[model samples]
Target: MSFHFEYPRTIAARRPGEFKPAAPKFHVRWQAPVTTIVSDYIAVQRQASDMAAERAFFQRMRRAFDSAYGPDSFEEMRQTDEAGMVNSIVVAYWTDIVRYALWKHVDSFNAWFRSTEREQEAVGYWRETLTVPYDRMETIFSEPYYHAGLARTRQAALEPMYTAGYFGAMRDRLPISAIDPLNSPYGETTPEGNYAGGPVRRVRVDVPPNVVSIRSGQVWQKAEGEQLDDYYQNLQPKLETGMAYLKEHPETTGYLSLRAIVHLDKDGQELRETSKHGYFLALAQLERWAAEHKSHLDIFKHALAMRRKYGADRQVVTWHEVFVLGTTPSLEYINCHPGTGLLRFANVWGNPPPSN
Candidate 1:
């Protein structure tokens, strides 16, 4: 017999009036000249066997992050997989690129990378540094009362643009060639694309004493021919359904704090694989949700069944990482819409209230 479990209404849902809009305006901002350090630490060798070593590597990096940038730096949310894996990412933002360059050359930072013992460990590391100038980027916060991402920089806000709809909309302002080269591997023809617009979706659920905030990021890739058709027709709907399911059933899905779906884009620069990352309140909560949630299990089984029918070559998960992180209290937000980025966590993280 099939089992159906009913979930109670979450606190936020019960008292919708109490969860008032902190910031209703859409604030726009340009990316300033800053250094962004992207690091991926993976347990590639003994991925399944060396759990202890994988954890140790994470702890070592956490200590390094605390000692180096601490609270002053803009640290984005760390992403991790729901399916257990010893793969994680740490993204640190620095307003002064020069300082970051100098710190890399310092003895302590230099020694950590060069240590033979660390090099031979089961984990593998990859790093990239990007110096983004003011015009090269753009950011928007639908609810300005909460701060996060570039909002932590305290940059000034400009009026929002109708064209500024999605995560990569700013890429449109860049030279078209930067996105799709004339001599492309996918083909010489431009690929079909779609962008979902409007404000970032924020779902706040209050489970009595504990209140959880859920945010989303949608990163789409250009695809050609049948692949593109399948993405829009088949995969896209399923994804939308999943998102709706979470929104409708917050009591069961409350454990999920963040969900980002990134499509593979090897032909273009950066992020080469298609993957999903979900952040939970804690590792224990994630484990329990993964094991007990019926909707989650159905989706997991559907993915496996699809892979079996389509074959592994047709569906490849190149690489995935999962990270559990604590909130950085020292981060700053200036003239930002109160509802941006990690600022959504201000109340939960013990930060001061947003100044309208």
Candidate 2:
């Protein structure tokens, strides 16, 4: 039987509302008793000025991403960044850091990254990687049929979850928060023109500890007719607007950076899926935005309506994997545009929130 209301949680978990959820919810079950999983967000990007060259540059690097020592599973995604530059991203996953490290050693990736070739006239490249322990992460889904992110890691199952659609729900889902607040020592304060939007090559932002990141995705390749129409016509617009708001107003929203990507297959086939990769200073701030922000609420309202409309026939699938980073931080920007990835927040580590 599904343990929807009886899932394990600590004191951090929130009490449910008088009304049950509008629909069933689920979470990823690890293949075995594991402690950590490696999540790597690697991007090969370029400004309009270097578009053709960057695409050629990125194609040459594909072999490295698909190496024998590469991640257990991964996804190829594309996006046009806020700056109007285009980015091709590889969302790679490894059950452990050792294998990923091996891949790095075996592949020409590190060599190319450190080479002088990346120092050309135009900019393009960045990575935001995290090694999350089991206790520091939470995985939830709207349906048992579709899965992504860590679910591709040979998961045991997608079991029913108890707490969701409520403020503080993600915190309770993470076992560490039961005792520790998982607060970041820093805030999302980017001094305008200091470097955030300026020209900079080879930048590295030391991401603060306990910083939170989430990969929320939507898959609708299976939808047909009305369900498909609803997702694109109504639900998608809400999501786009919300993500744009977060990307543009990170300082106020506590979002360090947001990347909205369209999924693609290895063969360059575009898939009917999208993902939002958002980095925040703390989980509390993320919760605050989700619970109170108009942008997010709009998305929530439309999604709920779609769920109600389709009922069991709902072909749209949504899921997310949220985690708080530990002390070991690994983020880098190489010959990248000033606004690429977390490059905007480059070199701002452990500083108190910039004076209001």
Candidate 3:
């Protein structure tokens, strides 16, 4: 019913005749002031030639992964179906200091990783990390940025570019934050706090591949407390109101892809509610909405606090994304807490969850 492989003998026993390349040292160069790293990790258990084969492979693969990584229905990591396969990709950013550390010691890290027991257990899974460097040009800002309580593995080293001269400006212009080398989509560990660091740059993506055909999907959370009843009731009204707003503004044209409703909670209390609309040419419109109807944002936050007070539960919202085979644009949302509502935006859409 299942298959496993023994650790490769050649990797285990390195003969003296083997030529082990010396580990390369990282070099610190004053190149780009900003760097972004995107990481994609995938697990493949079985393969098939066609749809029938694909489905069968998926079933077997799920079973295999479940057996290997799950028991008593416990999950270490979670996955979602993408365009064609299940995948997880995370984008993070780093300052020059962290980049220097990675570049100098990557070879040594890779060597140890390949020699690890986990490497021995990997059957068909493969992981790849990609880094991109960008140059920051111009920025239009509304507020100062801040990041707090980041996970240990995901903390970024913020290296101020003293040489880049981003410190000051004369009285004629608005204050702007620009990275000397602005790297988008950098892969860093997730911060433990609710907010992402920085003033938050919003990006508009071209189109989404995953949620194109999907019109709706089910959302669930462990049902508990009075919060459960009130949360969903509040969400139902918000969804209707939000969708009505989008439908009224359907004629607009920028990054129209999907609508995502994020229902987040604190403990058993359902506290946060965010509705993201994948717009088409609505970048300017989104900013306008936030500016004009700031009061609505207050109502939403109050809803969250009310949910928290009653030991409420998970709130759910159904969504859709626009996708086209040739050229469909996309958008992403990064919601700020009580202070700013859905303040920052990114280009990523329909990214799969990470496996534990």
Q: Of the candidates shown, which would achieve the greatest TM-score relative to the real structure?
A: 2
> TM-scores of the models, in the given order?
0.37, 0.86, 0.30
Can you write out model 3's per-residue Cα lDDT over 25-81, one digit (the tens) per residue? 111222323332222112232222233432443343334323221211111122222
Estimate every model's Cα lDDT from 0 to 1.
0.35, 0.75, 0.27
1 or 2: which has the higher lDDT? 2
TM-score computed on alpha carbons, candidate 1: 0.37
Which residue window of length 10 is worst by lDDT in model 3? 165-174
**Candidate of highest lDDT:** 2
Better of 2 and 3 by lDDT: 2
How much lDDT does candidate 3 score?
0.27
Model 3 CA lDDT for position 113: 29
For residues 1-356, write the lDDT of model 2, one tens digit per residue. Answer: 32112224445346465534756688987656666788888777766566465456557656676676777677778888877987877777887677778987878877877676776746568777788987888888888988688888754479876667666778877878777877666554533324554454556677768878889999999989988888889779888888777767766667777888889875656799999887887887777778889988888877778778767778999889998988766787776767676776764552324222
How much does each candidate deviate from the true structure in C-alpha RMSD?
A: 22.3, 4.8, 21.2
Better of 1 and 2 by TM-score: 2
Angstrom error of the Cα, residue 275, model 1: value is 9.7
Q: How accurate is candidate 1 locally (lDDT)?
A: 0.35
